[model samples]
Target: MVGNNHIRSVKNVRVKGIACAVPAHVAEVTSLTDAFGAENLNKIRSSTGVERRHVVSSECSSDLCVAAAERLISDLNIDRSTIDTLIFVSQTHDFTLPATACILQERLNLPMHAAAFDIALGCSGYTYGLWVAGSLLSGGGSQRALLLVGDTISKIVSPADRSVAALFGDAGSATILEHDPSAPDMPFVMGTDGRGAKNLIVPSGGFRDRHGQSTETSEPGVRGPYDLYMNGAEIFAFTLARVPALVKALHEANTASGKEIDHYVFHQANRFMLEHLVKRMKLPPEKVVLDVKDVGNTSCASIPLALSLHQNKAGSHLSGRFMLAGFGVGYSWAGCIADFDNVWVSSLTVTSNSETEGEM
Candidate 1:
């Protein structure tokens, strides 16, 4: 028997560093007006609060993750060999056969003894990654781990699909977690509802559906099963239904543990959905971090990217207790409370074609 409301805690796991990378290309919302119509595009901009997004054509999500990990390792002066675990979380992996984590471990030059794997999660990934990595670090001996997460969602999403075109972008992030007995305990709550999986998914290209055999390709406005498809209305309703409850539950748990949240970093789904969640939960607007305007939704990278971008502007670490909630795709969601005091936060890095290499 499994529980829907799962709670876990890990002690003495400190976030040592966080770095994010995105494609150099910027696509402004106004630029899409010619295709989506000026009036309709305006409405989208107003609703999603996205003005521009970083996109990549030739690059894969692994490329972005490798760039971010390299920057983090270089900036923090961390010994690559000490990283005992590497977790790569994303939906847009470089290949379907070998796990992207294995490729990343090699590209990043981790020790052969290091553990590596991939997690197929989208928006809820960062918080989940943090939990998984932190838990592994909490044990004795394995002192450090790299949790890399992101997605090149722009490639999978159809350019002609108005529902998700301007809503997503490409980016990757790396978070360094290490053992620190003095660090505060991190608490989290995670839940999933598979009933809503169909509301947002890429119906093909997987073993379950396979590729080049979808029936929806001929349908009006359908971009075949290989392309990303989203039922925005259903996702919106699902968020409205799940996010507030998750927030409230997590908030109560935090309160019970005598932890007062100093900031809320919800997944950068869109401005409208985030604002609604904040309002519904009666959380203070000042405490909520809404930095998605320029980056759009970078899937798993959004939360960490938001933190990185904020620190880049403020020129300081994200101090105090912060509540993070990520909900979307997988119909999966996770919420957590952690303190990032003195954590090394890097400014956003732009991806280049030369950064990607052919072999490890």
Candidate 2:
């Protein structure tokens, strides 16, 4: 269940193509008027260093996934029929009935024989999805798989819920992974704490509550209409308690590879969480890639989107190893710091004629 290494070994599978999509509706944080106000926006801006964010309009998570996947498949010039499997990971799903992967498979015109399904994960979903696809390829379970992640928080979010709205943006990313002989099982370290599940979640609007009418309520406390809720303090405590240990483990993985991790691309949660982790880990500021400028916190898409954009922008400096870590929602989290010195990611650019949320 492994390939040697993307960097340490000469036989790493290259990340041939990557594509990301965001909805048409975009507004800078400064666009927030008296509702959020420039003051609140400035505070978030100061903390997250984000200027703008994207939102999905009249679209569900599956719609964005379908659209994004189509764009990715076309742009990469991949024969959709060749995708042996489709793996989608996201906390926000399409409908409760059908798996979003199957829905996307139909949308992409891939062969029905090409297995498709979904993984219910949060921010770390992108990293977890890669490792899942990689393991399948290595174990001879599937040849090449498409991994897609998208969020529709723009619709789910209660405008009154300032906490989540200020940070999250809606987007999806797709990666095309093919089998390579020498790559190792991308060092996977994942965990969960059911005890903290309630810290970040939508308390209603599920099978559990489909019949149970949501009790009317308002915020400053538990509110109804049951929007995405988060106890920022609890989440911080949970992440602070968990991620550093994983960071240390990542360091160990890098040391054994004869190469220090040159960069760390963690989830684009927020700046407070990021700064705290960076200082505690003693990692260089440059090593912590901050791709959270315009897109804010894009949930499952954050890490891959970060990788997609940073690798595109960094150009020749893209070599060297980097750590990928994501923590949030599900009270579940995961980390994978791989040796990718030999990996070359094709830069993804969204053009005016492209099939992105805006252009389309």
Candidate 3:
């Protein structure tokens, strides 16, 4: 007996498998204090729930993507040969010539038919990536897609910037997208604004300007350098406005189910940001799920990381209507809900502070 909400569209998709990877190098706020000077580190830790974050070990975004992908493959015992599509989303790629997906395809050893490519976006990349995979799976364009969100924002960050440098960390998260082929909520909404592009960007390196050598550098409407920059205040203000509106719009617009949603996962930008967003959305604290306090912010990887952790950490207790919201970097954003019926989502330990780090 499927409930009214559970009945869904004859087509709402279920999340099949999710895996997230953090670099082995873990740091405590104190350690950060030691690295960046205790006075400055103190100011950072006091506000954000994050006590520590993972920094990639001598690897670029591709390496981190593969780390998460391996876990997804292992967890599902998925045949590497059958992955029909691979979408690697990241703002940071190893080089200009090869797509990050190509590097991933070779490393993951997938079938050549697997359409591998990179969708370069920032934080919104996860939600946007979901639409790509879901549409392909549901339409039978492909049976499955390895949706990988990877970023090493730390590499390009200016340590002196202080705004995003201390707040973001490097990591990868992957999900195996298979079709419901039956009851998926195929409709999705995505939005972007180039007007806010300067608010968050790595200003250089692209074929558009002939790989950083172009007249654009001397011209107007151009960026400065190939380094990461974020206006934290602007991002926060924008997210606060847009996220709640999108969530409510999706909730009202949903025809798939009538059940009240169970969980809400946001982009995990920071503790305060999420807290404010949750309140503005008027969700009870329990319904809002997050654990990004420790891992800093993993840019495109945030939402999937939340999903991977909450899947297991929340256990059998977390089955029902749930919504996912991702925003940032493009000034782009997206929102969607999933009916996780008859599905078992795995979990992992994702405390902001591990045993030695003390309280959250």
The most accurate candidate by lDDT is 1
- Per-candidate Cα lDDT values, in order, are 0.85, 0.72, 0.71
Which regions of candidate 3 are displaced past 4 Å?
1-12, 32-40, 207-224, 316-318, 342-360
lDDT of model 2 at position 281: 82
Which candidate, 1 or 2, has the higher TM-score?
A: 1
TM-score of 1: 0.95
lDDT of 3: 0.71
* Tens-digit per-residue lDDT, 1-360, candidate 1: 013455688888999889888887789888888889999999999999999998996999888888888888988999988999999999999898799899888899899999999999999999989888888888755688999998999988877788888899888999999999999888888889999888888878888778557665324563767888788898999999888777777766677667678889999999998898888888899989998788899999999998888778877466878898899998999888898888888767787775632211
Q: Rank the candidates by TM-score, best first.
A: 1, 2, 3
Measured by TM-score, the strongest candidate is 1
Total backbone clashes of candidate 1, pairs 3 or more residues apart or in separate chains: 0
The residue pairs that clash in candidate 1, if any, are none
Tell me each candidate's TM-score.
0.95, 0.87, 0.84
Q: After superposition, how far is residue 173 of candidate 2 from its true place, in Å?
A: 0.7
Model 2 clashing residue pairs (backbone): 3-182, 3-183, 3-184, 4-182, 4-183, 4-184, 7-341
C-alpha positional error of residue 209 in candidate 3 after TM-score superposition, expressed in Å? 7.3
* 121-223 per-residue lDDT for model 2 (tens digits): 8777887777777777765667778888777666667665667666778877777777766654356677777998877877677876765365533365434
User: Residue 69 of model 3: what lDDT?
Assistant: 78
RMSD to the true structure for each prediction, in A, is 3.2, 4.4, 6.2
